[model samples]
Target: MQIRVSIFLKEKIQNPNGHFVLQTSGPVPYGFEVPGLIRYFNAKGQEVRRTRFPSGGNYTSALRQGSFDLSGDRVTILGTNMYNTPSSQEMDPSTTSNSTRKQKQADTTPNPLATEELNLLAKLMGGMEVQKILNVDAGFKVNLLALEQEEEGM
Candidate 1:
């Protein structure tokens, strides 16, 4: 299944009614964060999560959106509109230093996601609604089977 998610950052004044929302057939807005009030709608345009993650990440499970009041006259969201944590499997190349070695190891032993890991991911998504607010345009698809090797004799 796939979810179509669109994420944009705008000042509070830009979205006064807070009607810009994202929704998928499946539970998507789980594990997202919204500092202020937001109005997530269903296919029928009903309110879902009032708040959403302005900043996106992988590690922290939750992120806060940026806020700006029109009265201030000067409000800017700088340095990358979105934020996200690295996936658990993403290794730090700087520390490893040996890219070839890492590649070989990864190819030999493809770590399968444990049940607990899947549950945690589901919880994070459910809690933060990551998919609802995530930038689908930039998101990529992963094929778990591609990471595993097929047995010759079964």
Candidate 2:
């Protein structure tokens, strides 16, 4: 499944206006190169983004927090962070960073999971906790172009 959010500029736009066109760092589509996983068009009526995620490919992506802003004739998709495969974590920069010596020092606030009870308590902290108290989808937020579409009555 693919979702798109686009903003139409009052004036014609150049490709430079496009944000996050494609990436190898975030979630990539099944059997597709990251460079082509997403396509961006800055033309007026062509919509801004086209992301592909073919179904039945055992492909699933985790969504990160996002927001949107809609104006008279424009929409802005704040950003998106979709998940790649679980086994592919080694290829993710963010994941790699977490293991960095520097990151480990900052979060050195030892995961309070040392004690069995705190370990259980950690399950309750969710997003605020580096490790979840529970995987309650606490930090997940999806922002779509619903407002812009609503104006179109669809």
Candidate 3:
């Protein structure tokens, strides 16, 4: 029987091992296997690491101890049978023609200034510092009428 499993990154706990707890919950079939494997993937769809659930009598038992030391800003998790095949499997370069490789190569070039990095830099520098660094001219002009009125009032 096929069972649906959902894995969520609950929170990162400070411990000696820098443990991160992942909560898994879903419908379980009778006599389902316990201590399944959980695979982690990066944004590039590459398998970075895999961890086994805690050994216990049932799937839920193992899932309760789903703590890992993995650290990443973004991650994708997959359980067994969740998909027909794992998404991280590398493509056979021989199967692809040269044109496909060329297109991929063109897209693979990393941008030096990503929007997120720029935003972070701006935040670090603050608005006034950024304006100064950019040489933004906050042009100040004196109003003749206002000056004349101020002198007359004085």
Quick one: best TM-score, which candidate? 3
* lDDT of the candidates, in the order given: 0.37, 0.38, 0.42
Per-residue C-alpha lDDT of model 2 across residues 50-86, encoded as one tens digit per residue: 8876432343343342223221111111222222222
Better of 1 and 3 by lDDT: 3
Q: Can you tell me which runs of candidate 3 are displaced by over 4 Å?
A: 1-90, 109-117, 121-154
Off by over 4 Å in 1: 1-108, 113-115, 127-154
TM-scores for every candidate against the unseen true structure: 0.14, 0.15, 0.20
> Per-residue lDDT for 65-112 in model 1, tens only?
323432211112234224433233333322323464456446555235
Tens-place lDDT per residue, model 3, 24-141, is 5532433445457788999999999999866543334222332232321111233222333323422332244556546545765656556446555655654322222355533222
**TM-score head-to-head 2 vs 3, winner:** 3
Model 2 scores what on Cα lDDT?
0.38
Q: Count the backbone clashes (under 3 Å) in each candidate.
A: 22, 4, 0
lDDT of 1 at 10: 41
